[model samples]
Target chain A: NAGVTQTPKFRILKIGQSMTLQCAQDMNHNYMYWYRQDPGMGLKLIYYSVGAGITDKGEVPNGYNVSRSTTEDFPLRLELAAPSQTSVYFCASRGTGGADTQYFGPGTRLTVL
Target chain B: DQQVKQNSPSLSVQEGRISILNCDYTNSMFDYFLWYKKYPAEGPTFLISISSIKDKNEDGRFTVFLNKSAKHLSLHIVPSQPGDSAVYFCAGGKDTGRRALTFGSGTRLQVQP
Candidate 1:
């Protein structure tokens, strides 16, 4: 089964443009997270969802929004993209318990100019 | 401030040799630690994990060692192969209700044949 799937492997956005990164998992995991990885920096959490219909802000949630409409899907939306938003975005899912292993999707690389 | 830190930006090792990657955390409440390996253009994959209650965990050629008193953890790979070349990340989670993880800047390991 496709563990975790992300759409649009690559994208380019102009300043002030907006886009959404799509993520879906077939594992029926209850926890999903969006993270952005910048060069020479660690992965920073952007948003997360514990389950469908519940989403929460993460460490670096300033320019992003997220929605979890179904257990399989949690999408991250970038509003008013800036140069600082250019980074690789990853979607991860994990079981409902604490300290469970997280499975990540092939990331989407976004370049904002 | 970054709660987790990986001081080494990169490491080089000869094939069949041992490789050690280090990581440190500033938060004393972290109870769970994990290591992930990533190839270029791919998502980070789970490698191994250690709980605060334990000092070491091993899987095949990979071993994770946690020193809670020092707030440091390390990943060791024995008989390293060229295929082991990848970026390695260390992540830590607190025992609090949320179980959110904080990751360190990854260390790029290059195993040369």
Candidate 2:
């Protein structure tokens, strides 16, 4: 089964342009997150949603925004993209119970020039 | 300051050898810790984990050990194989309200045959 999926696997944006990274999960998980991984760096949390309509910022949320209109989908919007936003974006979801192992998407690679 | 740190940026090991990746956290409130493995062009996936209440946790060929007093944790891979080569990340978070996992710069592990 396709556990988690992301759209626009690769993207190139010019400065001041905008785009959205789409994510969807079929696990019916209640918690989902958006993270960006820079070269040689760990994944930094950008934003997260506990469930539909509930979202919050995390470690690095300056150049991005997120929305969770439904449990299966979360989209990260890059408004006025900058070179600093060029990185790999990942979406993850996990059950609220059990070992809380997060399942991640294939990731979207964005390059802002 | 980086809350989580992995001093070693990369590690190389011979096949069938043991590979140990270290992680240290400065946050005292972290109740749960996890390890994730990532390959190129993909998102990180769950590997193993340990809770503050438990000193060690094991799953098949991987083991996670936690030292609460020192705020240190480690992932040990026994009999490392070429297929296990990848970037390894350690993440932890407190259950203050949400499970916000803070990640460390990953350690790239390469197993040579």
Candidate 3:
């Protein structure tokens, strides 16, 4: 079902450059999330959405933004990339009704120069 | 401020032995715990999960145990195989379904033959 798919598996951005990381799921999940994993650290939540048009900030939402225009899509936007933002980004989704586990997409490795 | 932590960065086990991975969480609000396994360059796949209401849940060769009072949980892989070699991540989540999960720094497990 293409559980979750992300675009541009790898990207390199310069300081101050902007980009949007795309995430889509064909599973028809009601919940979608964006997370970043830095070396030697756990995955940190950046943003999430419960449904289309409903998005909220997560633990590390400072340098990112997100929008859930449709149930199938949730995109994360980086306004100004920085070295600290260089990390492996992942997209995940989950269905409702007591499903506690999430399905993850192959991560996008970003490097900011 | 790390809500979840995996004390061990890596562990090596002989094939056909048991592999025990531990995780601890600081947040008392976490009502569910999950374990995921990831291969290099691939996304994480759910292994097992235990709810706060229950202390243990078993799935085939994998089992998850939860200790609510201590805020600790663990995943056990019995008769581990070389194919089980991967990074294991433990995550905590609330039952609300609206909140994103807090993940632990993954433990790289190497099941050597």
Predictions' DockQ, in order: 0.73, 0.70, 0.82
lDDT by residue (A1-113, candidate 2, tens digit) is 79999999999999999998999999999899999999989889999999999999998999889999999999999999999999999999988874588899999999999
Model 1 residue B84 distance off true place after TM-score fit, in angstroms: 0.4
Candidate 3, residues A1-113, lDDT tens digits: the string is 77899998999999999999999999999999999989878888899999999998888899899999899999999999999999999999998867458999999999999
Q: Judged by lDDT relative to the true structure, which candidate is superior, 1 or 3?
A: 1
Candidate 3 runs further than 4 Å off: none
CA lDDT of each candidate?
0.92, 0.91, 0.91
**Number of backbone-clashing residue pairs for each candidate, in the order shown:** 0, 0, 0
The DockQ-derived docking category for candidate 2 is: medium
- For model 1, which pairs clash? none
TM-score of chain A as modeled in candidate 2: 0.97
Docking class of 1: medium
Docking category for candidate 3?
Answer: high
Let me know the DockQ for model 1: 0.73
Tens-place lDDT digits, model 1, residues A18-94: 99999999999988999999999999888988889989998899989999999999999999999999999999998
Q: What is the lDDT of residue A61 in candidate 2?
A: 95
